[model samples]
Target: MMVKQERAARTRQALIRAAAEVFTEEGFALASLATISRRAGVSRGALHFHFDNKKVLADAVERQAADVVARMTGEAEAAGDALDALVAATHALMSRLASDIVVRAGFELCGGPTRNTGAALRWQWQVWVEGTLDRAEREGLLAEGVSSARVAPAIVAATVGFEVLGARDPEWLSEERVARFWELMLPRLVAVAR
Candidate 1:
């Protein structure tokens, strides 16, 4: 029983990984389950057993990616100071985004018919941004009355914009430029002292 369960788990992970790669390279409309099964080297039956459809496979990928993002956010929170934490988190996330084809593919899949998958990813980022803002406000880093609700969306927007830009011309956006863009933009949203 244990061996069977282990194999099943491995098969599931393999499908998720393979689907992410295919989706990232081909986008949702073009990616197919047969291709994903072939990539994973698993029987089509095994793929169906693990996920009901491509939508389910995409959700699994998004969940796995969100787990990674959540962990990085937690690390940033533990690092101290809101601005520094946010910077650290952004750098960590961008680094992962640049290297992880699975994550890049998950983002590409976000525009599909799976509203739940897209919402899950958006909510994950929003929660992280809101948490960072709340911490900054509590630490006296933000100007008084600065609402996390208001700033969280902007922060998320900037991050997404950077990701899109990086995706288009990775050579042009280098890590240094991405970091500098965030640093320059963050202050504009900081509360002005009277």
Candidate 2:
């Protein structure tokens, strides 16, 4: 029974990884379950046992990406400086998008036209960033003139833009690109001690 459960777990992970690859390359609409099963090296019965449909497989990918994001953001939240934590989290996200197909597919699935996943991973990320900025404002980490309301949207938009642009040119999601973005924004966003 233990061996069976272990095999099942491995099969499930394989499906999610395979789905991530297909979704990242072909996108939600064009990605097919047969292709995913083939990539996973699992039979159709095994695929169906793990995921009922393509949307379910995509949802599993999103869940995995969310887990990755949550772990990174949770670490950032543990930092002493909220503003610095936010910056670090954003940098981590850019690096993840560059390296992880699961993370890339999660964002892509959130924005796709086909099915509504109910909760968009991108929206969750935007909310987390906005909340972090608001915390920074409350902690007096933001510049005197900098407002969380104004800054949150811009940062979210820029990050999403990076994700979109990275789809075409991998350079857009590079850590150096993210660092350049923060280099310009940090001075404008962080408060200077009087």
Candidate 3:
């Protein structure tokens, strides 16, 4: 029974990986289970045994990717300072999204048929950012008038904007460019220390 469970877990992972590749290359609308199964070298029955349909497969991928982001963000939250943690988390997310094809596909899937999954992920990130801001405010790290709700979306928008731009032109999105973006934007959102 243990062996059977292990095999099932491996098969599920294989299907997710295969689907990620196809989704990255062909996108959600174009990606098919047959292509994913072929890529994974799994039979249709095996693929179906794990996921019931294409949407289900996409949801699984989104969930896995979200888990990764959550872990990174949680680590950032554990860091000493709220503002620093937010910056670190954003940087980590952008760097991962920039380099990972599967993550990119997951981002794309958020707007396609699996948009609900995307929205859920986005909401989670936004909530994290807002929570960080609230902590910063409590700690007096932020200016007195700053609202966590306002700044959270702004930061998220900026980070996601950079990700979208990077996806379009990786060559133009150097580390320097990203650093410059943060430099220019962070001050506007963060409270200035007197």
TM-score per candidate, chains pooled: 0.84, 0.95, 0.87
- For residues 1-194, write the lDDT of model 2, one tens digit per residue: 99999999999999999999998888889988999999999999999998899878888899899989999898888875788788889888888888998988888888887868754788889989999999999988899989999999999999889988997799998888999999999999988982
Steric clash pairs (candidate 1): 24-105
Please name the candidate that would achieve the greatest TM-score relative to the true structure: 2
Q: Extract clashing residue pairs from model 3.
A: none
> RMSD of model 1, in Å?
3.0
Candidate 2: misplaced stretches above 4 Å?
Answer: none
Q: 9-111, model 3: which lDDT tens digit per residue? A: 9999889888988987888888889999999999999999899999999989888888888898989888868888987887777777767666666666775
Error of 1 at 173 (Å): 6.6
Give the per-residue Cα lDDT of candidate 2 at 157: 94
Q: Which residue runs of candidate 3 sit more than 4 Å off their true CA positions?
A: 113-118, 171-174, 189-194
Assess candidate 1 and give its TM-score to the true structure.
0.84
| Clashing pairs for predicted structure model 2, backbone only | none
